[model samples]
Target: MSGLDDVIAAETSLSEVDGLNGRLVICGYRLEDLAGRTDWENVLNLLGGRMLPESAALRERLGMARQRAFAETRWLDDGIAALSITEGLRALMARLPDGEDQETALLLAAAPSVFVPALIRCKRGMAALPPDPALTHAADMLAMLHGRAPRAEAVAALDTYLVTVSDHGLNASTFAARVVASTRAGYTSAVLAAIGALKGPLHGGAPGPVLDMLDAVGSPEKAGRWIGEALTRGERLMGFGHRIYRVRDPRADALKAALARLGAAGDVDRERLALAEAVEREALAQLKVKKPDRPLQTNVEFFTALLLEALGFPREAFTGVFAAGRVSGWLAHAHEQIEGGRLIRPQSRYVGPKAA
Candidate 1:
């Protein structure tokens, strides 16, 4: 069971990752059916078992939650500021008033939207702008980050990104959250644990590097040669493979479609999209010949990079943005684990020094 592959750790009515079939199901709705059909507020309401208010009301509530979480902005200690985005996010979450209530969960979900833009602004020596509680969550995030009203296309693209990443089946971060919550720890503690898990390169950290890979390859004509060389050197072609899905990731297609929408609306760099499509084609073709037995296809991380770049986020902030979307899923998983009423205590077989 190396890497805990194929392990069934818990049961819940949240989301299911059908790896072989390349399907993602949230609650009862297919991910594809929900992607362009709803926004994050409604998605949260769906996963939260309708405990969350309706979309319009929830938008107002989350907007207010963003403002409340903004209060922690003043507590951005030097240590927090100096850390990486995910680390800084966890440090900031640790500073929130400890609680396990729904209100506290909402605050945790709202905190990243408030803080990520501030962190970006702080790094550039720009003063952070206050949240506009009236704007939709995605629109408000873009406005805060850019210090101006964002294009409607950009807002739509970011909303799709958020909704696409909101929840997946028992991912590492969600599992970490559930494990911590099983111990009766507060919601903040569970979310902090999830953030730590997500910071690892094997998980949430891959998308940023996907951009780096695309950059290094430089052009469409060079993509095949570049990927071949990377494979020869045993370097991963970031964003080209998934741990679960044997086919192209559904989220990849979802984000790619969002990027296309932006491109059609004249809001994104279409040349870059063209290059990415070429690279993806080359990567898939080369991967098939290189590893005949393994099915490695473009994943969510592939288009995640392109979309976030289009939306004005630095590659470094990718995981933090991902956490912003995924926090709701963590909240749901933690609550489910707590309600399940069983502590997660898995036994490990010792393979170390023997007792002779």
Candidate 2:
């Protein structure tokens, strides 16, 4: 069965999702290799590929894109006191003009602009912090969010996150972007469509719920019971299971290992990591009882919540940050779509009344 109740797209090279075997490939690189080691700029380079010049030119291009996006935060000229980040983001989005070439890259780079400033504006009861063009990409975002630069490890962790999520093959959001791209819509339209798709409960929105589950379970000791109850009620465990990656989210191990590299494995980190593992095991056990035919396993969201919490992003910002990374994939797809010059047109068998 297909996901489209609203729209249809034939195919695209944006990314591939292999749900049964638990594999995801972005462009040509496996996700695990790219997550922690590659910086956002590097991932952007990889995604943009030969279209982006190598070395200094690439850095200069990313720098330009970042600055262009940074400038867009000024569009937050209205709405306050009660607007949600989603509302604010959609509003700011409207200010951007359509003629911008491959508009997806700018939107992708602007994820920090949409999220970081909105975070501060909501918290500070003011407009928001301006983007600091001088800082590195992740560092600038953290600085905007907190009104100061982030610590080294935290910055690195965020970089890991952006790189990790930069793209995934045929995820709901990326696929949506490709679908829109197939229609030959302007790039920004495709990106906006992707963001709306991702906002769905089934996609990137799962991280915050994972955090809540962790809190309710409260300890590693209660993990098994929590899993049992959630399964009993037919409530899906937030962190466990992937539409792709049957065994594990390869990104999970990659991110956990990155967290270890922060060298902050004090009691808090250790406990969080342990509880995460415990939850994974118990969830798997319960899933075996309930869903024997298809074994569900841990997705990246479980550890992503813990890790982002450790890095000081509030639970609310988790999905926003995910948007920040996924925009990169959207841009790549936009570029591919534009170059192909194929107007995305698909036919569906009509099941509704039409004039004969």
Candidate 3:
């Protein structure tokens, strides 16, 4: 029962994470097929059980939802600005009215994209920009954050990241969303619960630290020495392993390829990318030698850090950005749980003292 290993909590058709085979299928499409070739709105539509062409309508709805979230949460003053990015998002999301419909889902999904950038600006003493409904979801988010239109390559990279992390089979945050939804509490409440779970270090928070590790290693030549020392100290390497993936994480490859594309467009630091690749090789070799029995290869967070940093997101806001992408899956899972029409309560055995 520890860590609920192999527990079948709920059946879902949204996305499947095949850890053994290093494959990810989202709504019947392989992740590699969707990551760069499609937009995040299309992925959202697919998760919602709609056709790919319906992305146009979903894009417009999401745009309007962003506008509403921006207008209603205009109270992002010094009080809210004092909080961390993720905390600020949670505070704003708490203001959304309770509901379980698609409209509610759209609002919940849009809140992070609006609030994360706005919070980033607020922290820096700048005004928040409004969403441009005409642009794609990823482009608009980048435009709002940077106060201008982003390059096409940047948008594509961001969209790929969103699609890549949109959903994994019953991750901690998605499960939290489902558990809250099983009570029929509303999509907003469920999404809020998911964000809380994602804020934890073991879940959606590792991407930021991955950058820190890279900075500490400093260069490819030092990578082996730094990694060896760190392993000697028994510190867990950020972005290196996953609870499910025994082989290399497929999402890591997807994002790495995205990073390479961004570099090709002259948007990313090629030297940094090269250093990261060298470090990855060193880390994998070290892991293999240190723990021969364990198959600890690279996971999604490895390239996620490099890609998002290239896209100009601050490290502290990484998890909030992750929530923005993942809210789609959370909402979809919430709807699925509501349809099942059962409470998610589980029984636990007594391990403490028993009463007479």
lDDT of each: 0.87, 0.70, 0.90
- For residue 8, give model 3's deviation from the true position in Å: 0.2
Better of 1 and 2 by TM-score: 1
User: Model 3, range 26-65, lDDT digits (tens) per residue?
Assistant: 9899998998899888888988763112564777888888
Q: How close is candidate 3 to the true structure, as a TM-score?
A: 0.97
| Candidate 1 lDDT, 1-356, residue by residue in tens | 68898778998899999999999999898989888667777788888764455655777889999999888888776666788877777777888876777688788888999899888877777877899999988899999999999998888888899989999998889999999999998889999999999999999999998888888988899988998999899888888878889887999999989999988998778778878888899989999999989989889999999999988899889999999899889988988888889999999999899898
lDDT of 2 at 241: 73
Best model number under TM-score: 3
Best by lDDT: 3
| Candidates 1 and 3, the one with greater lDDT | 3
Clashes of each: 0, 7, 0
- Tell me how far the alpha carbon of residue 80 in candidate 2 is from the true structure, in angstroms, after superposition: 5.3
How many backbone clashes are present in model 3? 0
Model 2 TM-score, 2 decimals: 0.87
Q: What's the true lDDT of residue 274 in model 2? A: 74
